[model samples]
Target: MPKSKKRAKAAPASKAAAAQTGLSRRSVLGGGAIGSALVLGGGFWGISSFRTYAAEHDLSRVGDGTLAVVQIHDPQCPTCTALQKQTRRALRALDGCGLTYLVADIKTPEGAAFARRFNAPHVTLLLFDGQGGLHRRVQGLQQAAALEEVFSAHKAALT
Candidate 1:
């Protein structure tokens, strides 16, 4: 009779070896949750950082020989935040166009007075001529292109 070969059995995993086999499912899930929380927290922080309301002094000073773009808005209003971002982009695009950008918090006393002076409700953009006369009063959020066109028109009218 022919002798049969015996099969070798595999060794079981040791505790240290099993532990070094990379992150477990629970560990990976926990890490992901922590990462997500951190990212979300950072995002909220970033957005909040930009949520500044205009001071009273900011509304009082209007530059001469420049197109004054006064933005009157409430700090807590989402519409105001959206308009603020857009307005910043529009102003940057109109840089060197002899334009002065001003922001006002509608909730402040000075801001309320200014708003009443212009009869603006909220999220208003007031364009002023070089002589500080109201050229255009746009209520609500306006497109950057529209703002640019308005600025150009006012600039032409001023010169």
Candidate 2:
């Protein structure tokens, strides 16, 4: 066999031995990748936090009862449309749970105007109990599964 070929093969074996004895290239690389990702993610989040958007309505209630969602939605808002679909699906999933879903219309200028009077412009989603105790508030659109989990998590207080 050629010396060069033998040396090339031996190189990998030496690396393997080095790994077995102490630190490996794979472990070091993995740690570096994780560290860099964490830093990048933190920086992105920090910058995002500084950007403020228009506030929505507030959903509030009080009670230790069934799962109830009060959504004050404006028909013209893109986010409101998305939440309508998701809320419908979520309510369907929690069928037998005696969940109450309320969709207060805030579609037109008059609707939006009315909603604003009720603090509807500051919030999108709200979960309340029987006694009208405010449990959860979701600013943006929430998925069906996520809504279910929220209710399930508070099942003890529900029933």
Candidate 3:
């Protein structure tokens, strides 16, 4: 005589656009998470691909019959940046000195190998003679005057 409980009416989905389109709440959340992961991953990849530290280095020419000064660099280190500023000032002061200024950015494989090969750490400077032989290794943050003196002495030794 009475209607059965199993024959109850269904919930309303006839008016909602998402319900009409057959999209579920779980699916929507999943899609949003995937999209966010992809965007963040791409952004991280882009940042690393075009890193700014020593971006213009050419390690191949380091030993090409020229006296050289190489800085073991790390882009994310504050002390390394300070050392870089000091090195730059010294180089500018010693302009026309035939000493090739180079950077071995540890972020790159070649640069990392170079640093390892010489046992050099970040914020260190390597002085190379005309034949690319290691002459001196100076470590830590240095004043422009001190760097200039070192550069000048090394340059004089080569000449």
Candidate 4:
């Protein structure tokens, strides 16, 4: 009878090592891919929502005027926050303007109809020159100087 060759025994796997490798593989190939897809999906949705907001509004109410200001804003929008901050500073510099700021929530469909009349975007800043006239409407995120210029453009109506 021919002698059979003995096979080498395999080393036992370490529980910790197996667990770590399993998790790493899942993260790199499985969950990681899903996570990336979710991020891209969210980004696309956000941009589309912004476009819809822009289209739904008329913005006729934001023309040159001398009245309290009304702003249709999306709090989730960073540009809106920045615009609001800058407009507030400008308003403070000009006294007796009697600008009453009415911040309207219009980031969603329910508020879209009301916001449409204002013709403002998802993020916007508007100033009413205390004379029942709209002086300026600013859209998007802008630097302090640019924002100041927008306020300055309506300097005649500041008082």
Candidate that scores best on lDDT: 3
lDDT per residue, candidate 4, 1-159, as tens digits? 123222222222444565767755556688878999999999999999887656434343334353555556777877777766766676666655544455656765645664676576666666666444555676676665675555655654565
Output the TM-score of candidate 2: 0.48
Compose the digit string of candidate 3's lDDT tens values, residues 57-155: 777767789888899999899999999999989889988878878889898898899999999999999999877799999999999999999999998
Selected candidate, larger lDDT, 2 vs 4: 2
List residue ranges in candidate 1 displaced over 4 A. Answer: 1-57
Task: Name model 3 segments beyond 4 Å from true.
Answer: 1-56
lDDT on C-alpha atoms for all candidate structures: 0.76, 0.67, 0.85, 0.60
In model 4, the worst 10-residue window by lDDT is: 1-10
Q: Model 1: number of clashes?
A: 0
> Please, what are the lDDT tens digits per residue for candidate 1 over residues 45-159?
8877655433223755564666688888888999988887887787789878877777777778888888888888778888887667887887888788887887788788888
Ranking by lDDT: 3, 1, 2, 4
The CA-based lDDT of model 1 is what?
0.76
Q: Is candidate 1 or 2 superior in TM-score?
A: 1
lDDT of 3 at 81: 91
Clashes per candidate (backbone, < 3 Å): 0, 16, 0, 12
Please, what are the lDDT tens digits per residue for candidate 2 over residues 28-102? 799899999999999988776554111122223223354567677767778888887887787678776676666
* Residue pairs that clash (backbone atoms under 3 angstroms), model 1: none
Worst 10 residues of 2 by lDDT: 52-61
Top candidate (TM-score): 3
TM-score of 3: 0.65
